[model samples]
Target: MNGLIGKKIGMTSIFDAAGRNVACTVVELGPCVVTQVKTEETDGYQALQIGFGEAKEKNTTQAQIGHFDKANTTPKKRVIEFRDFNAVEKAAGDTITVDEVFAEGDTINAIGLSKGKGFQGVVKRHGFAGVNDATHGQHNRQRAPGSIGAASYPARVFKGMRMAGRDGGRRVKVKNLKVIKVFAEKNLLLVRGAIPGHKGAYVILEK
Candidate 1:
């Protein structure tokens, strides 16, 4: 009962009880099916493997097909294992809805893959102010990452310097987002403020 698998369904603004307009991200919480249960004695840990979303049988591997078959469900596009889950009594193929886990005004954390911004310069990637502004005959120094290395001391750039390369497309967790509303019938959850990733991306909601 610590977390559930879900999808980011975009955003909407709602007026809260305080009459303030609060931005909320809409998430389609599970109706996740339990695919497997690992016990401490058997797997050295206790966890529940849950599956959500539909997957094509052709795209699903033979091994995965059999795994889903044992759960009596179709292949799932997303599978996540929740460790130390103990609040609910569930077996394989049991569907868990949003209302079963979350209530209004619950502060939770959301984990998702952030949108990728390919290789970039330090200014855009790390919010560096750049070398300097265009001044007395200064040319093309505004966006440059200047003075990366010392003249002679050390004779090499220090490792982990704030230089830019690839950016984004990584797992990001946004914490302390309060649950605004929950539509159990539609399996949707509304939380205050924005979360990571683009629309339709899978997100893990943790209590």
Candidate 2:
């Protein structure tokens, strides 16, 4: 397997062998169950549909319950399909753990939803300088996105202007994050640098 579904546990600093404090994010990786296996002839592509995290049977739909039952496992909260996983031979109802896929010193990518910052201005969202010193009779217009369009030739604002509306809460991927440590017993992965999303958010780790 080349990837696993995981959760962002939070961030912490750990001392490296060089005695330098390295900031890292803690992720709780999975013992994911293969719910479905797709082949080129069957689904027009080769992929594995894996399920992670626990879900109560009452909260799960009947179809999903049957799907999990087919895998001989309980309901899972997050299900993701990974293509081009040709490194190992796996079948439906197989379990893949994090330790079997990742190790320390390996580089991987993490994908998750970024934290939401609602209704922000260009100063915060687009990193505008914000009216320089806020002087020259500027009061509340410091954070305003000034002079968005021309008055004569181009009368309308352009479609792709960098003016802010909503910020974040979108899919973000952080690549080449070095794996600092992997605790197989606890199912924790310590990776250098930050990944997307808030605490307890689900993340996908790929190699």
RMSD of 2: 1.6
Candidate 1 clash pair list: none
**Cα-based RMSD of the predictions, in order?**
1.5, 1.6
Instruction: Kindly list the per-residue Cα lDDT of model 2 for residues 177-197, writing each as its tens digit.
Output: 999999998899999999999
Among the numbered candidates, top TM-score falls to 1
Per the 3 Å backbone cut-off, how many clashing residue pairs does candidate 1 have? Answer: 0
Q: Write the per-residue lDDT of candidate 1 for residues 22-118, one digit (tens) a residue.
A: 8999999999999999898999999999999999999999999999999999999999998988758899989889998889989999999999999
For candidate 2, what is the lDDT? 0.91
Model 1 misplaced regions, further than 4 Å: none
Name the best candidate (by lDDT): 1
Cα RMSD of predicted structure 1: 1.5
